[model samples]
Target: KERFISLTIKKKQQDVVRFLEANKIEFEEVDITMSEEQRQWMYKNIPPEKKPAQGNPLPPQIFNGNQYCGDYDSFFESKESNTVLSFLGLKPRLASNVVLQLLGQVTVVQ
Candidate 1:
């Protein structure tokens, strides 16, 4: 059986995000402007680029939080994320995003 899959690159970030979200698809947004240090980190760890044609790079992750709560504290320190982190204030969203940006270094591609 053969299934056809289409991959279209969108010029605008918001439209790309909206399209995936509206369809319940998922993706990681890699910031083209990341510092060298960050790119090195992603390349060293993630294997997606090894076979760019086949693998969909898995977005960085927050890992399983049920086993690690202290891990949550260290991530929400940044000024931008801190705002959302602080507003949510010790709820699941706090932990969710803290891990999302910190370890994954990702912002849900939105």
Candidate 2:
């Protein structure tokens, strides 16, 4: 059972990383296993309502700088809804805007 949980956590973390990379979003991966400080920071930053009732929240917690974005499940939901940028507190770039930018036809107004 423990092994299964470990594999599941790795898969979720990989999914999050893959999504971020595919979108060209810059991110830092923290290894909580290697750093107690980071682990505690993650735990401390998670909101009370988001914590699991039985144990410390698992890995794949998303954050934008110091702000807690959400866990993997929340990330997956936002991805499915096509709101990942907003979910990560990022400015959403419309598909049309991207095409225009590629062609140098217009400047994207933030």
Candidate 3:
């Protein structure tokens, strides 16, 4: 799944971008303020219930491929749980480290 985020040039949007960059996450940003068509398209694709409670229905909307993954809060939650990698169809590096540690614990009898 490709990582995509819809956002305007707002402070909150910038914060999300910063967070992703700090975590070394790759993502494509669609600036809704720059493109009305994109803004409208985002609105049409994301259901009202899924939209933020602010009622503006504007950006910072995060998505994994075509699936809407909520705004910054949701993204943060996924990040905290280390599920964002899985959502992007990427192998979880942390899990792999854990697996390797487990393997290292096993000692074969001579």
TM-score of each: 0.26, 0.81, 0.56
Predicted candidate 1 versus true structure: per-residue lDDT over 10-100, tens digit per residue? 2223432443356453445445235556445444443343324664332322222212212222222322364423332234232332222
- Please give the lDDT score for candidate 2: 0.63
Which ranges of candidate 2 are over 4 A from the true structure? 93-110
- Candidate 1 contains a number of clashing pairs equal to 0
The superposed Cα distance between candidate 1 and the true structure at residue 49, in angstroms, equals 8.3
Clashing pairs in 3: none
> Across residues 9-106, which tens digit of lDDT does each residue of candidate 3 receive?
25555665565567565544444556667666566667688866776554555554445556656656777897865543346442111000000011
Per-residue alpha-carbon lDDT of candidate 2 for residues 26-103, written as tens digits (9 for 90 to 100) = 554445676677677778878999999989888777666567778778889999999987877778652211100101
Off by over 4 Å in 1: 1-16, 19-32, 48-106
Q: Best-fitting candidate, measured by lDDT?
A: 2
Please count the clashing residue pairs in each candidate, in the order shown.
0, 0, 0
Candidate 2 structure, TM-score to reference: 0.81
For model 3, the superposed segments whose C-alpha errors exceed 4 Å read 1-9, 52-54, 87-90, 93-110
